[model samples]
Target: MFNRRKFIKTGAASASLLLLDKQSFAEILPRQKTGKEQFPIVISTWDFGVYANKEAWKTLSKGGRALDAIEAGARVPEELDITNGTVGRTGTPDRDGHVTLDSCIMDEFGNCGSVAAMENIAHPISVARMVMERTPHVMLVGEGATQFAVEQGMKKEKLLTPKAEKAWKEWLKTAKYSPVMNVENGTNRPGGKYNHDTIGMLAIDAKGNISGGCTTSGMAFKMHGRVGDSPIIGAGLYVDNEVGGATSTGVGEEVIRNVGSFLVVELMRQGLSPEEACKEAVMRIIKKKPENAEKVQVGFLAINKKGEYGAYAIQKGFSYAVCNAEKQDLLISGKSYY
Candidate 1:
């Protein structure tokens, strides 16, 4: 009763069917030719990105690598003295009044590194790069991240500035916490035009390589150990040299739920323009949570390998900065769902 010949044929047919099912779900579109390529360009989230873009252009204009340029750009915001509690050491503290930071970096070769819920280190982005280049890990968090920074010769400083502490004391009076939409546009800040959440930058260098970086202090008055999407690859940031790069701002939770940046790049790979891809990603979030989408803000900025860029958001007031050889501080308002 053991028919070996028939069993072999049936097993081979079943294996072929399984393979076909896998391919159907994972089919990638062919890379299509887009418009003219713009070499040595940089783009970033928020109006503050203008300053960051200027810094990045310093390297990009000179034909530097995109990875170096984006890191330089990201540092500009981290080193700013007046970031309005949005990024770097001056960022608004967690509910417990501690300043924790998150950051991530991705290079052209698909290499990425991240640090989340880190403290005392001024530049988490640099530590992220060190993680990507030195260690075999993609992420480090909390005390371990801080220890690595110290061992690498980065000094530990009191990140809680007088102004930030004063604000924390004020917030403690009420302690009622809810994320304000468009906080980066100065919607809910007490008295500052620079109040914002995150800075995410993407670049394309002369050699046509793409890289991206995202850094944030996370939501104002978030849970003490809360880590948002800023340091999570494919959520807050993603870069594929062959396809393109994308970075996100606004509510990190919504972005993470949708794997926002990676979705944008994959949509681009499917032959959608950067703007179209960004819009598609935004719509997915809105569709999944129509009620919640009304209260939160989420935005995505994307650039393809051909140098075309665009952005979309869940609410209005989202804007991004662009820097190329022709213009250094160009700002564009992103199209929104609501």
Candidate 2:
């Protein structure tokens, strides 16, 4: 005969036990539903750097990667005629009124590429991408970079615009007689110390991938061919998925002198918070030789996957633009790019 009653009792007990086990497992496992899934992207500009426009953030939100976002955001200043120091149409011109541009890109893989003191290209960062994808070299410069741009089918055009010419003429008329003005002197005021030639971008994708890029019209009034830090790998842009992504803006010489981007990433790898790393790097510049060095203005911005974002500067005021899945805000912090 079938023992229906016993079998039913046993099955019920087993079902209850299984339910309890599942409940226990659920309690033991972490509840990550509230955790951050996708990474956030950040883009910033110091005092004179613009971030109010959300056009760039919109592209990233629409699924554009960091590289796309970087070029898009950078081209804003290039086309709007902002910052006369480095790679745009309005960048300060040399005594001859010729404008040169500098740019660099760092990929998620940590491979970096750049172009320095390049002329005639409106979008130097795009050309830098060509260098990265086409050639095995890390950098290219001047006429060579221009030639490469042409060979890559980049449109060629007059390097100088009317605005750049006006800026150069204005600078010449106000020129003062000083050793700083003498061509024979090492420092011919290529770009005024206060002049800035760089803009930086750091971005983190929804997948936690990070990349950085920097673009600039080379220093205003440079020695016709002087290159600054905008195109230097570690000085301008750096990305290490193990740490974070970093970009620097302001005086390229000072940024390069401090090895700005790499120093910040290394600091983060040593367990320093991104903010601490940025602050430390800027503070180091403040402590450089000759006691109070020329106010070397530099701005740094970074973000780790933890949603922890950081920025610091050697100047009196610095501002950065940030866009997460939620919103976009230009975080204006501190006083300057010291």
**Which candidate tops TM-score?**
1
Q: Whole-model Cα lDDT per candidate? A: 0.81, 0.62
Q: Which residues of candidate 1, in runs, are more than 4 Å off?
A: 1-37, 187-196
Q: What C-alpha lDDT, on a 0 to 100 scale, does residue 168 get in candidate 2?
A: 67
Per-residue accuracy of model 1 over 179-241 as CA lDDT, tens digit each: 766666552342122233799999999999999999988987888999998999999999999
TM-score of each: 0.87, 0.77
Per-residue lDDT for 99-129 in model 2, tens only?
Answer: 7788888877877778877878788888888
TM-score of 2: 0.77
Clash pairs, model 1 backbone: none
Distance (Å) between predicted and true CA of 222, model 2?
2.1
RMSD of 2: 20.4
What C-alpha lDDT does candidate 1 achieve relative to the native structure? 0.81
